[model samples]
Structures are given as structure tokens and as C-alpha cells.
Target: MNLLHAYVSGRVQGVYFRGWTRGHAQRLGLHGWVRNLRDGRVEVLASGPDNALRELQELLYEGPALSRVDGVEIVAMADEEQPTHGFSIAPTV
Candidate 1:
């Protein structure tokens, strides 16, 4: 399993980024949540197979059609922190 914690910046909020993330993650069979940050960024935490995580990382760079993703900062998390459920769109933090 692979765990990815990412902070996506630039034109990510107010554009259904969280929804898009949830759908994509779920389709990839990843487990975790995506939410908006108070600092005009989007935060995502996902866990799944290595290939799935990598594919998601690539998609994060593009984001939704209405978004202008500038960058994505990703960190590998410990397996112990991985979630054991479906993907979701969390409340803004």
C-alpha cells in the first residue's frame, strides 16, 4: 500500500476540486479524504496501491476544468496512518 498526503495550491478552491478528488480517488479504489484549507489550498490524503496513488498524484496537478492548479506538494505517509474506508470530501479546515 501507498499513502499520499498532498497540499494542492492555486485556484483549487471554489471550483469543485474536492468533489473531483473524491470521485477520482474512489474510482481508483483509494481510501481517504480531500478538503479545502483556510489558506486557499486543497488538502488530500489518500491510501491505496502504489500505481493508483501515483496516478492520483498526476491528476492532482491538473485538478478540475475550472481550477488552475499551480502545484502539489505530496508526502508519503506511514502505513499505520492509512484509512480503511471509502474516499470522501471533507469540510474545509
Candidate 2:
């Protein structure tokens, strides 16, 4: 399994980014949560098989058809951990 944390930046918020992310993650059988950051980026933490995790990152680039993702910063989470039961759109922190 692979765990990843990504920050997707651009015109991402208020454009169904979180919703699309959750839906896509669910479809890809990934587990984690996505939320909007106060700084206008969308942050996501996902854990799954390596392929699934990599696919999720690709989806973040063209989020929601409404989003304009300028860039994404991805980091591998060294500590392997199982995520929650399902993907979700977490409340902004």
C-alpha cells in the first residue's frame, strides 16, 4: 500500500473540487479525505495500493471540470497507515 499527501493549488476552491475528489477517490477505491485549505489550495490524504494512489494524483490535476489546477505538490507518507472506511470531503481547518 502507498500513502500520499498532496496539496493541489490553483483556482480550486468553490468549484466542486472537494466533491469531485471524494467521488473519484471512492470510485478508485481509495480511502482518505480532501479539504479546502484557507490558503486557497485543496489538500488530500489518500492511502491505497500504489497504482490507485498514483491514479488519484492524476485526477487532481483536472479536478471537477470546473477547476483550474495550476500545480500539485505530492509527498509520500513514510508511515504506512490505513485510512478511514471511505473517502470524504473534510471541513476546512
TM-score of every candidate? 0.95, 0.92
lDDT of 2: 0.88
Identify the runs in model 2 with alpha carbons over 4 angstroms from their true place.
80-82
lDDT of 2 by residue, 1-93 (tens): 678799999999999999889888999998899999999999999988889888998888888877899999997666745585889888897
lDDT of 2 at 25: 91
Model 2 residue 21 CA deviation in Å: 0.5
Error of 2 at 90 (Å): 0.9
**Model 2, TM vs. native:** 0.92
When summed lDDT is taken over every stretch of 10 residues in candidate 1, the lowest stretch is 75-84
CA-lDDT, candidates in order: 0.93, 0.88
- Clash number for each model: 0, 0
